[model samples]
Target: MTIPDTGLRTEPGSFRDPTNQVFHLGGDVLRGLDEQAARDYRTLAGTEFFRTLLAAGKVCGTEPVDPLPGVPWTTVLRHERIPFVSHPYEWSFGMLRDAALLHLEILRAALDHGFTLKDGSAYNVQWRGVEPVFIDVGSFEPVREGEPWAGYRQFCQTLLYPLLLQAHLGVDFQPWLRARVDGIEADQLRPLFRGVRRLLPGVPTHVHLHAAMQRRHATASTAAVRDQLRAAGYSRELALATVRGLTRLVERLDHPATESHWADYQRTCGYSAEDRAAKERFVEAALAAGPRPRLALDLGANDGRYARLAARLADQVVAVEQDPGVVDRLYRRLRADREGRVLPLVMDLADPSPGGGWRGVERASFTDRADADVVLALAVVHHLAIGRNVPLPEVVDCLVGLTRPGGRIVAEFVHPDDPMARRLSANKPVGLFPDYRTEVFERLLGARCRIVRRLDLPSGTRTLYLGIVGD
Candidate 1:
C-alpha cells in the first residue's frame, strides 16, 4: 500500500523512525529514508556484515538503488521483494522463535562487523521456509564502545519474553502481542508468569531475569542507567554473547503444546467413510478438470485437507490459516515431508498482513502475494460470512481476485437449510445467498467466468462449483 510496490496507493505510509516512508508505483517499491538514516544505510550496506549475510544466504538479495533523480533527502535500496510479508505475531511458535533467534544472530554478526542494530523489533524478519531472513538493512548503525545495546531491553521484551511465555506458560501470546501492537512489554508478562514452578524446565532464565534487570533502567536516572550499563560491560562482545545465549534458548524451544493439526489431522479428520468419499469426489473432479496450476492459494486450509487434494493439480500451495497450531503442523509437514510442495503460512484473511517498514518500503502488505493460478475457497466462506460477518459477494470477490484471468475458482456452497448452516446462523438469519442460486450463479458466471460444471453431491447441503474465468 506504499508508494512503489503497486499503482494502488502512492500515499505516504504511517511508519516509525521518522526518517523514511515507502510508496508504490506498479511493481517496483520505493523507500523514503531521511538524510541521516540514508547515510547510516549506505555505511551499513557497504559493510562486510551485509555482504557476509548475502554470501551466507541468510537474507534476501539487495542492490543499491538510484534515488529518483530529483528526490530530496532520501536514499533508496532495492530489495528483492518477498512474495508476501508476515509478522512475528502471525508466525507459528517455530517461526516466531526462529525469527527471534535470527534477530539475535544478525545483531551478533553486526557487532562483530563493527555495527549494531539501531532497533530490536520483531517486525524486521521474514521467513523463507522455516528459515528467518533479515529484511532490514537500514536498521543497523555503527556502534562505539560506550553505548549500551540501545536495543537491549527492547530485545528481551520483544523476543525473549514473549517466546518464553509461549513455550513455558502455554499461552498463545499472539493475541496478547496483537492487542499490544507494539511488542509485548516485559512487565505485563512478568506478573502473569511468576510463581509457575511447573513451567521451570521450559522457562528461559532470560525472560524473568531480563525483566527484573530492565526494571532498574526504568527506575534509575538515565545517566545512572547508562553508567550502570557501561559498568556492567555492555560492549560489542557482550552483545554478541547475549544474543548467542538467546539463540540457544530459542533453539531449545519446541512448541509448548504437541497437539498440532497436521500431527493430529488423521486423528481429528478421521472422516467417516461416507464423508471422505463425498469430499474426495468433489476435490478429484475439480483437480481433473483444471489445468495444472503452478500456484494455488488455499483460503482456509485447516490441516491442508482439500488444499492437499488440490495440490494434486498445483506445483505449490500456500496454505493459509489463522490458528498457529494448525499453521505449525502445516509448516512442519511442508518442510519435512519428502512429497512436500506446500508453503504453509499463518494468515487471518479477515485482517491480512498490512504495510510496514521505513516509509513502508521495508515490508510489502500481505495482499501483495495474492497471485495464484487456482484459488480454493473450500468450506471457508461460511466462516467468513457467518463467523466474521463478511458479506458473501465480497468474500467471493476476494477469492476470485487471487486467481489470474481464466484461472479457476473452486467454491463450495452450503445450503441454509442444512443443520451446519442452521447452527452457523443461530444468532440471527443474516439471509442466505438467494441471488446466487442456481440461475443467478450461472448468469454471474457467464459475465465473469465460464461455469465449467457444478457438482451436486448426494448430500443435499453441499455443492461444488468450478468456473473458468473470462477475459
Candidate 2:
C-alpha cells in the first residue's frame, strides 16, 4: 500500500503488519486500516465490547477520520498518543508481569465478544503511567471455531518464559530481553530449571513440556502442525482454557527484589541533613530560575528522588537507573501514586541502549530518543568516569548530546576526596585521572555549554552546576 506524503511518516518499528500501518501527523498518532482490516474494524467498532475495553483502560481509545491528502485508506483511526513509548526490555519485572496479565485479560475478554487476538508480541503493549494498555487495535479479528490461538507459542516465548525465569531462577531478565528482542526461547531456557524447580506445577506443562514439544516439532512444516492441530480437534473452548491456565501461572509468579547499592542512597550516603537540604535548595533554584522544559531526563535516578522533583517542573520525566531492583521499586511507587508524569526505565548509563533492530533504525538509541529540555545528572559523574573508566571529556560530551540545543542541565561534580569517589578510585593510582579536577571539567563544559550557576554543597565534597547547551 502506498501511504500519502502529507508530511505523515510511518514509524520504523511499526511495519511488521500489513493490515494496519501507524503514522504520525502533526504529533498525533494515526492508524490506516486496509480494506479487510477496515471491514473487521467496522464490525468491532460497532460492538459494545470495544467500547467497554476503552472505558476500562484496557486498550487505547481511537477516533475515526477520513482518508488523508493522497492516501486511499479504507478507514483511518486517530489513536491517543502515549506520552512516552517504552519497550519491554526497558520495563522492570513487575511492569512486564502486569503487562503479561493484561494481555491474557484482553484475550479472555475478547473471546467473550466473539473476537480473538492474532498475536502476542510484547511490543503490542505500552505503559500509560504504570497501567498496561494494549496499543495494537488491528490484532483483533473474528474468532473461528476449531482453531487454536496463533499467539500461544509467542506469548510463551515473549512473556511467560521471561517471567518464569526471573521468578524461579532469580535472574534479572532485562539484559536477556534487551539482547534478544524475541525473548528467551523454550529450548534455551529449559535447561536453566533443575532439581525441585523442574517439578513445579506449571513448569512441567508450560516450560518443560512446551520446550520438548518445540524440539520435537523443530523440523515439522507449518502445514504439518496445522494438520496435527486439526486432527486433534482444537476448539475455542480449549484455547480459552489454555489462556486461563497460563493466566493462573503468570499471576502466581513473583520476584522478591534484592537491595541494590543505590536503592537506599539517601540514608546511606553519609550526607548530613544540612548537606542534603542544601542540595535540594540548589536543584529547586535551578528549576525555578531556568526555562521550563517540556521533557526532562534523569540519569542514574536512584529511587527517583530528583526525577520526582523534576516531574513537578516538566511535562514528562524519564528516569533512567542501572539497577533493576531500584527501577522496580520506583515503578511500583509511581503506580501506587498514579503518577503519569514520571516514567522509570532500567538502563546502564555507561553502556546505554543502542539502536539495532532492522537497518539500525527500528528501535532508536537512548541518545537518539532523548532530546530533553533539561537533564539531571546527580551524584553519577564519578561512577561513569572512574568506575566505568570513561573519560571525563566523553562524559561531558554525552551529557551535552542528551540535552537539546539551548536546553539546561543540572549536574553534580564529586570531588576526588569524596567518600563515593574515593571508593570508586580506591584501587586505581592517583595519577590515573590527572585531569579529573573541577577546573578541567569546568573548562571542558564551558566549551560546549554556558555555565549559568554553580553552588558548593555544605558537605564540602560536591559541587552542582547549571549550564545551558550552546547553539
Candidate 3:
C-alpha cells in the first residue's frame, strides 16, 4: 500500500475533536472520518434540516463527497476548502459575543430537530463574509434527555469567561487564548476580581460562578452533581435558556476600551508631509515587485495604514497586530466600508499558532500563512526583535523563510540614536542590540536577497530597505 498524504506545514488548535480529523490536501481542506461519524455526515448532508440551515444562511453548506469503494474504513472524503480560518482570539469582543450567540443559535436549531452537537468550541465557528458558520459537522450526535451538553463549560470558558474579562476588566483575553487554546481557568480569574465584582453584573455571574463551580468540582463528584441538576428539571431546553441568558450578559458587560496608541493613532502619528511621501514612494516601489500576490501578510499592520495600501494590490491581505485596539480600529474600518480586501487580526508575532493533531499532522500554524509573495515589515522589526527580545539574526531568518525565491521584503530600520529609538532605548533592546548597525543589517539581508533599493526617510533618522531573495 502507498503512504497516506501525511504532509503538513503547520497545526491548528481544533484538531482534538474525537469524531473526524481536519487536514490540508494540496492547499485544500479535507476531513477524515470514522465509521460512525461518516454515517452521521452522510445522514446530515442529505437531510432537510441541514438544507434549512444552509438556506437560512445560518451555517455553511456541506457538499457530499463519496469515497472510493473499499478504500480503508478510516478514509477521507475530500471537500471544497474554506477561504478563511479564524480564531476566537482574533475576534473582537462583539465578534466573540456574536459567535457565542450564533453557537447557541445553531445548537438550539439542532436540538429542535432531535439532534445534539457533541462540542461547542468557539474555534469551530468561522465567519463566512460577514456571518459565523458552524463548520464542525462531525460534532453533531443524536440528542437525548437528562444528559448535560458536554460543551457547556467549554462555552463558558472559551466564550463566556474571556469576554467577561474584556468587559469587566477592560482586558482583551485574545492574547491569553493564543498560549492556552482551551482558554483561561478559574484561578486565573482570581486576580481579575478587584473591580469586576463592583462594576459588572455579567462578569460576576459567568466568571465567579464558573470559577466557583470549577474549584468545587476539583474534589466533588461531578457526575452525581450533573445528574442532580438534570433531575432538577435542567433539561436541554432549560439549559439552552441559561446559555441564552449568559450570552445576554455580554450585552450588560459591553464596554469597549480605548488604550494607548489606537485611541489617538491619528493624533500621535508623527508622519510629516515629506515622511508620508517618502513612505508612500517606498510602498509604491514595493508593490511593483512582480506579478502581485493573491495573498499578502502585513506584519505589524498598525491601524491598517500600510495594509490598506497593500490591500489595493492584492485579493486577500492578512493584517497581523498584537495590539487589540489597533486591530479593533483596523477591523472596524474594514467592516465599515467593506471596500478593502483586508482581514485584520490580533496575534502576537513571537509565539504564533502551531501545527496540531494526532502526531501533529492535521492543522497548520500561523507561520504557514506567512508564505506570501510579498511581506511588508514596515516599522515592525523594533517590536519583534528589540521589544519582544528576539535576536536580529533569528528575525532575519524568519523574514527570509516567508518569501518565495524571488519574493520581496520591505523593512524599516530605526538607528540607535533616533528619537523613536531613544524612547525605546530604556527597554534594554539597545543594550542587547549594540551590534545591529545599518550597514550590518544590509550585509546580512544581502546574503539572502538582492538589495534592490534603500533610501533615507525625510524624517532624517530611519531608513527603508527593499530587497528581493536570491537576486
Candidate 4:
C-alpha cells in the first residue's frame, strides 16, 4: 500500500475519543480506528439508514481507506472536509436548534437500525453553510441488549440545556456555552427553572428529576450504577421515548423576541435610497475589481445585505455579527433560501473567538480560520473602535490582517461627528479617544492597504474606502 508523503497530523479536537483519531494527510481527512471501532464502522457503513443520511447530506460522507503499513489501527477511513469548522458557541439560536434537532433525528434513525450513538456532543455536528451534518462516524455502536442511552446526559448538557436556557429563560446561551466548554450540568440548569417555571414541559423530568438523581447518586460508582441498570433490563424503548420527549421539548423552544438595536438597523439606519444605492455600487465595483475570492469575511454583517453581494463575488462568505438575534434572523432567511455558500455566525469582533480546548489548539481561533480574499468591514469600524473601546490602529490592523495579500477590503469609516459615532461615544470624557480622526484612519489604512478608491458618501459623516493589500 502507498504511504502518505507527509506525517499524519491528528486533529486536536478529536483526542477525547480513544476508539478513533482523526488525521489530515495532504488534503484528505482521515480517521484511524481500533479493532472494535473498525467493526462498528463496517456495520454502520452497510446500513441502509446510514447510506440514506449520507446521500441526503445529513451526515458527513465517508469511505474506507487503507490503513498505514506501520500503524496500529485496524482500519482507516476518509471523510469529506468541511470548508469551515465552527463551534456551538459561535452558532446562533436557529443554528443551534437545527443542530440539536439533527442530533435527535440521527439518534432515532440509528436506534431503529439497532445501533446508537455512544455519546452526544454538539461538537460532533458541523455545518455546511446553513445545514448541520454529523461528522463523528466513530460515535456509532451496536445497541447493547439492556443498556440505556449512554449519551443522554451529554445531550441534555450540550444541546437541550442551552436551548432551554434561551427559549425558557430569555437568556442568551452563547456566553454560558463559551464559559463552560463541557456544557451546563443538570444541577446548574435546575435552579433557573424554579417556582412556576418548574411546571414547564420537560423540566420536571429532564432537569429537576435528572439533577435529583445525580445528587442521589453523588458517591455511587458509575460502573456500579450502569451495571445495576443493565441488570434491571433498561429497555431501548425507554431510551427512544426519552429521545422523542427531548425532541418535542427542543422543537417547542424558541428564542424570545427581544429588541436588538442592529437587527432592524437596515430600516432605521439614516440612509436615503440614493445613498444606499451609491454604497452598493461602490462595494460592487470593489468586489468586481479583483479575482473572485475563495473565501470572504463580512464583518458586522447586519441583515446580510452586503454578505449576499459578497457571495456573488466569492465562492464562500462568512457573515459575522455581535448580536445573536440579528445573525439568527439572517440565518433563518438564508436557510429558507437554501443558501449553501453563505455561513452566518454570531461573533463580537471586539472579543473574537480564540484558540481554545486542550492546550488551546483543539478549537482554532477566529483569526486562525479567517484568511479572506475579500473583506467587508462596512459600518463596523466605529463600533469596534468607539463602542468596544478598541483603539483605532488596532481596528485597522485587524481588518488588514484578515485580508490576504493582493486581496481587497471594502471598509466604511464613520466620522466621530456622525450621529452613530456620537451615540457610541456618548458620555465619554472629551479626548477619551483622541486618535478617532478621519486623517488618522486614512493614514492607518494607507499604511497597510493600497487605496484603490475612496468615496465620501452623500452623508458627510461617512466615507467608503476600497483598498487592495500589497505583497
Candidate 5:
C-alpha cells in the first residue's frame, strides 16, 4: 500500500510492526492502522475494561482520525506525544522492574476481556515521568483457546531475565540491554546463576527451565512447538497463572545498594552549606530571568538537586548522571513524589550515548536527542577537562550543541586552585590543560552564545555564567 503524503514522516524505529505504523504530521503523533488492526481495535475499544485502563493512565490515550485516502487503512489514531522518548536501556533498575509489572498488569487485564498481547517487547513500553504506560495499542488480539501465550518466551527474555541479572547478581544490565535491543537471553543469564543461587524462587522456571527448553528445541520448527503446546492443553487459566507468578516475582525484585562516589556527593563534596546555597540561588535566578524553557537538560545532575529546581521552571527536564546508584536514588524519589516533570538518566559525560541500530538512525545519540531550551552544567567542567583529559574548547562546544538557538545555558566554572580541580589534576603533569581558565572558557563560549549574566560566589573559586545561544 502506498503511504499518503500528509506531510507526515515515519519515525525510524517504528517500522517493525506492519499492523500499525506511527507517523508525525506537524505536532500530532498519529498511528495508521491496517484493516485487521482496525477491526481488533474496534472490538477492544467497545469493552469497558479498555476504558477503565485508559482512565487510570495504564494505557496511552488515543483519538480516532479519519484515514487518509489511498492509505489502505480503516482508521488512524492520534496518540499523546510523550515529552521525551527514552529507551529501555536508559532506564534504572527500578524503572525496568516497574515497566515489567506494568506489562504484566496490562496483559492480565487484556486476557480478562478475551484479548491477549501478541508480543512482550520492552520497547513497547515507555515512561511518563515515573509511571509506565503501554504505548502499543495494536498489540491486542482475540485470544486463542488451548494455545500457550505466544509472548511467553519474549517476556522472559525482554523483562524477566534482565531483572534477574541485576537482582540475583550485582551485574548492571544497562550496557547489555543497549547492545542487544531484545534484552538478555535465557542462556546468557543461566551461566551467571550457579548451584544454590539457581534455586532462587523464580529463577528455575523462568531462567534455567526456559533455557533448557530453548536448547532442546534449538532446531524444532515453530509449528512443532505449537502442536506440542496444543497437545498439552495450554489454556487461558495457565496463561493467567503464569502472569500472576511473574507479577509477584518482578514486584519482589529490587536494586541492591551499591557503593558510588556520586551517591554521597552532597555529603562528601567539600562545598560548605553557604556555598551550596549560593549555587542554588544562582541557578534559580538564572532560570527565572531566561525565557521559560519548555525543555531543560541538567548534565552531571548528581542527586537531582538542580534538576528538581529546573522542573519548577521548565515543562520537562532530562537529568543525566553517570553514576547508576545516584540515578537510581533520584528515580526512587521521583516515583515517590509522582514527579513526571523530571527524567533521571545514567550516562557518562566523557563518553555519551552513541548512535547505532539500522544505519545509525534507529537510535539517536545523546547530543542529537538533547536539544533543549536551557542547560545546567553545575560543577562538572573540571571532571571532563582535567580528570578526563578533554580540552576545554571541546567541552564548551558539546554543551553548545545541546542548546537550541536562543536557548540559555547556566554553567559553573571551577578554578584551577579549587580543591576539586586540584584533586583531579594532582597526578597529571602541569601543562596538560593550560587553557582551562574562566577567561578561556568565556572566550570559547562567546563564539556560539552571548553572555547574559555572571555571578562570582563568596568562595572565590567558582563562577556561574548565564549565556544565550546565538541566533
Candidate 6:
C-alpha cells in the first residue's frame, strides 16, 4: 500500500536494505516495510524468543504504527529513539565486544526458532547506555534450507577481526573502523597472525580458512555456491553450531588496556581532598542553578566522575574520552552497575569522528551531533590548549558552539603554573604558549558566554567558570 508523501527525512545510511527504510519525523524514528519484510516481521515479532529479548532490552523497542505517508510500504513500525547515536568507530573495545556477542546471541536464538538475521553488519547494533541493542528488526527472515549463513563473512570483517586486532595485537581498532566501514577483509587480517599468534583459538578457522575460501570463489557465482552447499547437505544444525562457536570465541576475547596513561588519571591526579571536593561542589552548584538538562556532554570524561554527576541532573549524558583504554574501563564499570543514562565513547577531540559512508552523510561528524543542553569541560582545557596546541579562544569557541543558545557551560581553566599544565607544556619551547593565561581564557570565554559565576579552587592553580551561552 502506498501513502501520500510526507516530509519525512530518510536516514542516509539505511538505503542498503530496500525492503525496509528508516526515516525521522519530528522526534520519532519510523521504518517502512515492504510486503515481504512486513510478513517476516509479523512472524518474528510473535516469537517467544523475540519477546524475551525485548523484555531483556537486547533489541530495540518496536511497535506497529499507522502507515506513514512517505514510502510505499505494506506496514510501518516505530522504534524507540536512541539517546545519542554513536558509531562503531566511536565505541571502546569492550563496547564492540559486547555488541558482537549480542548479535551472535540473537542469531543463535533466531536459528533455534527457524529464523535468522539476513545481514551481519556491526552497524545493526546500537546502545542504550552500556547495553547493546540490535536495531534492525527487518533483518530477521525465515531460514533458507541448504543456504549458508549469509552474514558470516560480514560479521567476521566488521566485528571479529576488529576485536582480534585489539585483543591480540594491542592495536586500537577505532582508526581501522573509521577508515573503512566495511571492516577488515579476511585476507588482510590473515596476514597479521604470524608465528605463535597463528595458533590462537578461532584464528586458523575463522581467519585463515575464510581467506582461502574468499580467494577460491572470488570469481565464482554466489548462486552456484548455494547450489553446491545444498548438495552437500548444509543443515540448520550446522549453522547453529557455527553461531554458537562464534559466540564463545567473542566472549573469550579480552582487551587488557596497558598503554594509555590517562586510564588511571583519577588515582594519580594531584588533587587534594579539599581541592577535589571544591571542584565537585562548583560543578554541582552550576548544574543545579540551571534547568535540568535533557542532554549533557562531558568532554575528556576520565573515569566518568563528572559525567556521573551530570547524569544526576541531566536525562542523558554522553561521556567522551580520547583514550580507548579509559573508555573501556569506564564501559565495564557502567555495564556492571547497569547504568543506563551515561553513554561512554572513545573519541579524540583533537581528531574527532567525521562524516563518512554514502556521500559523507551516512555517518555524522562529531560536531554535527554535539548539540547539548549543557556541556562540562572540566579538567579539559589544558589538554587542548597546551597539549594539543589549540589556542585559548578557539578552545572556548568550540565548547560554546556545542551548547544551544542560553544553555550552560561549566568549564575549568588550568593555569600555566599548575603542575598538570607545566607537565603538559614541558616539552615545548620556552614561553611557546605565552597566552595560555587566566586573563586570556576569561576574556575569550566572556566574549561568547555571560559569566554566571566563577570559583577559584582551593589549590589556587585552577578556576571554574559557569556561563550561559549567548545568542
- Using lDDT, give the best candidate's number: 6
TM-score (all chains, Cα) for each model: 0.77, 0.95, 0.83, 0.95, 0.96, 0.97
Instruction: Find the candidate with the highest TM-score and give its number.
Output: 6
Candidate 1: deviation at residue 414, Å? 4.6
List the pairs of residues colliding in candidate 1. 2-23, 2-24, 3-23, 3-24, 4-23, 4-24, 4-25, 5-24, 21-359, 22-359
Name the 10 consecutive residues with the lowest summed lDDT in model 1.
5-14
User: Which candidate, 3 or 4, would have the higher TM-score against the true structure?
Assistant: 4
Full ranking by lDDT: 6, 4, 2, 5, 3, 1
Q: Which candidate, 3 or 4, has the higher lDDT?
A: 4
Which residue pairs clash in candidate 4?
none
Instruction: Give the total clashing residue pairs for model 3.
Output: 10
- For every model shown, the clashing-pair count is 10, 0, 10, 0, 0, 0
Worst 10 residues of 6 by lDDT: 1-10
- Please give the lDDT score at residue 237 for candidate 5: 90
Across 182-289, the per-residue lDDT of candidate 3 in tens digits comes to: 677766875677563734676565667667877777776868877877788768787667656765665565655477765565456466789878998888778876
lDDT of 2 by residue, 1-471 (tens): 224558888887877889898888888899989999999999988889889999988899888987887765789899988867777888888999999999999999888888999889888898776788999998999997777787888888878888888888888887887787777888788788778888865788888888888888889987788778878998778888998998988889988678877789878877888888988888878777766778899999988888898888888899999998999999999999888889899999998888867777777788888998888988888889999989989999999999999898888999888998888888997789887888888888888899999998898989899999988
lDDT of 1 by residue, 212-329 (tens): 6767566787678768778877776776776776677778877643665445644553345665677778767776675788677888787787777777777767778878788877
Q: lDDT scores for all predictions? A: 0.68, 0.86, 0.71, 0.89, 0.86, 0.90
Better of 2 and 3 by lDDT: 2
Q: Lowest-lDDT window of 10 residues in candidate 5? A: 1-10
lDDT of 3: 0.71
RMSD to true structure for each model, in Å = 5.0, 2.0, 4.0, 2.3, 1.8, 2.0
Tens digits of per-residue lDDT for model 4, 52-103: 9999999999999876766668999999998778888999988999999999
lDDT of 6 by residue, 1-471 (tens): 122467687887888988998988889998989999999999998999999999998989999999854467899999999888899999999999999999999999999999999899899999888889999988899999988999998899899999999998888999998999788898888878978999998899999989988888888899988998899999899999899889889999998766567977987777889989999999988888878898899999999999999888888999999989889989999989888899999999888889988789888888888888899999999999999999888899899888999899999999989999999988999988989999999999998999989999989999999999987
Give candidate 6's error at residue 13 in angstroms: 1.2
